[model samples]
Target: MILKSPFPAANRFVTIQATMNKTNPSKKQVVVIGGGVIGVCTAYFLSKKGAAVTLIEQSSIACAASGKAGGFLALDWCDGGALSSLARTSFNLHRSLAQELNGKEAYGYRPLNTLSLSVTESENPSRGRKQTLPDWIDGPVKSQRTIGTTETTAQVHPQLFTRKLVETAVAEYGVKVVIGKVKSVETGGGKVTAVVDGGGVIDGDAVVLALGPWSSKFTLLSSVINVHGVKAHSLVLEPRDKDAISAHALFLSYQQAHGGQPMDPEIYPRPTGEVYVCGMSSQEDIPDDPEQIEPNPDSIRVLKRVAGTVSSHLGEQSQVKAEQACFLPCTDDNVPVIGEIPGMKGCYVATGHSCWGILNGPATGAAMAELVMDGCSAIVDLTRFSPARFVKRRR
Candidate 1:
């Protein structure tokens, strides 16, 4: 079942044209840099709003964290902070998109139950009886607590969802995807005129830098926004009897038998018959190239060992399908930097999402489109997330 387009052509064109006429601008040409979830979603929303969008990528679409991430979605997980509103808005958009994309089956979208587990030194079997756990989790589970219910939490196959958004934008609208590494942004008359890459210059009326951690590498942007990367390692495993595994996400705080520090590993059993486990963050320097990102052998070994202790099905090393690592973008304060830069007219940025990039991609895109066309976001209030905050502190 194919999902219907939420933004009909006639309505989109009318709405965008009406907004553009207010500024007396010609056709809206938007150039989005990066092909991760954030960039693709920005391009998708712009196209939905009847803007001419060109998405430029150094590598293939979703080739980094957007593809490798464990696509866990939570509505209230990020509450009690500045991110509360943004997280809530994005969670709702995800629910709507699941239906608009022909239901959860299409993109591996589904509600999940989440639990928190802690390991203990005591091997007494009575320790396991204090909390309820699925029969499949047959290891050193000392304590378990339900953290989220199905109504509040969900999951998606990150790569599939990212690719779908770009595909839909291309087929339904006329959005363009260009393959090239953006070298720099060309500015004139106090506004961005075009993006210069290896191939050639792609002109645009507006430019968005959404290059994840790689955004910092561009001197033009690094001088303005302070974004860095936190490297993480993960593994995808295929269980022998996938049906036996329950649809529950596990956040395990493990105590290694011979260890000093406790290792926290997360396990998510996907609808696609695969289990994803991730933990172990490193302060390693960000690579200049996305393809150069590599997983530490020790990290992988530790993860494999943790998986074996988590569940019987995941114990088989032969079931391991992929072992990988990627860098998640972060800011000094940990809040995302999303909005137009103060000095760089027509230049916008949407990165530093860290682990929540995939979960909040759609809302960020929608808000960005509104900011670009209507001069402010009509959906979510982005005053606190403006890139100007970083620029002001530097002065």
Candidate 2:
């Protein structure tokens, strides 16, 4: 478990709000647990909407999947599915946010020309047909096709983006950051309290459980629905000719020499002059702590091979920036479970976006704030993502 990244922490009641406890008697006090993008965004929007927000985390911000995962965004990738509206709404919101937050300079926000390609490591580069792929992609390319244009695709530095939201929320919106793990959510009378691991209790009018993959570890949530963690690996590489790597994002069907099974790896070139490659995934027991998570060496090695097979610039000449693993939260139904928890008024859970967490973070946060503060969300329809859908199945 690594405690640090190229990124970076907070304390309880750290912000100077109107009051030591509630901040403002006129505003709704909302406590959001988990400091991942989902939770941070929730806190951001809640505070932006005039709610007194307190965000609690066990470790540094973006230390888990939020920081480790590749930050790819698409407008219609979730089209024809339950996530279509949410994805679209979030896509648009990301654009507006980029303009408002100086996202290009703050968090590496930019539109991308995305592609899908097939590469065989053993195949001779000269034996293949002339590829119309980007020049930097000088490898054993077998086939290529344009999957996404700049109009419908974009990306961000996930860790940077998440951290930026938190910074804005704290500096401008009066959102408090608490550095502690939430033990449980308890409701007595009409108020809700978040019990922290160190005996700290945060009182709030409402509470959101954005525990990511750890949502399953909570009995109150696990009893209603399961949030399983899928361990995924990624590597950040700084190529020798960073300028040569375009802003194109690649979705590849990669095969090594004497192939066993073709691997589906994805690549994204960042504005920070580095490229990200990710692929190898498996399911294993999620550890009790995010800090306990570690990438499998074999998976890391295979990802390196895949990166080299995709482009020479990312081959031996490239420097590895990060080799890490994080667990993506996924549900059995394959749709994110949002909205309030049944029978527990003012208690909500938002998790299980899987790989789309970064793409969908803004809308999720906006929708959650609307739902929590206005009694329903106008940002996007939350009907399909309700946790009650599973509660009905449980019945």
Alpha carbon deviation, residue 132, candidate 1 (Å):
2.8
**Span of ten consecutive residues with least summed lDDT in model 2:** 1-10
Local error of candidate 2 at residue 343 (angstroms): 0.1
Clashes of each: 0, 0
| lDDT measured at residue 26 in model 1 versus the true structure, 0 to 100 | 67
In model 1, pairs of residues that clash are none
lDDT of 1 by residue, 1-395 (tens): 01113222221111111111122236588888888999998999988998888777776778899999999999999999888888999999988988998646678999999999886433443466554688778777876889989999999999889988888888887776666677888766744644344335666678989999997798887998888989999999999989889999998888887867888889999999999999989989987777788999999998988888777688874398999999999998999999998867888999999999988999999999999988999899999899888888999
Per TM-score, the best of the predicted structures is: 2
How does each model score on lDDT? 0.83, 0.87
For candidate 1, the per-residue lDDT at 387 reads 87
User: What's the residue-level lDDT of 123 in candidate 2?
Assistant: 88
TM-score of each: 0.91, 0.95
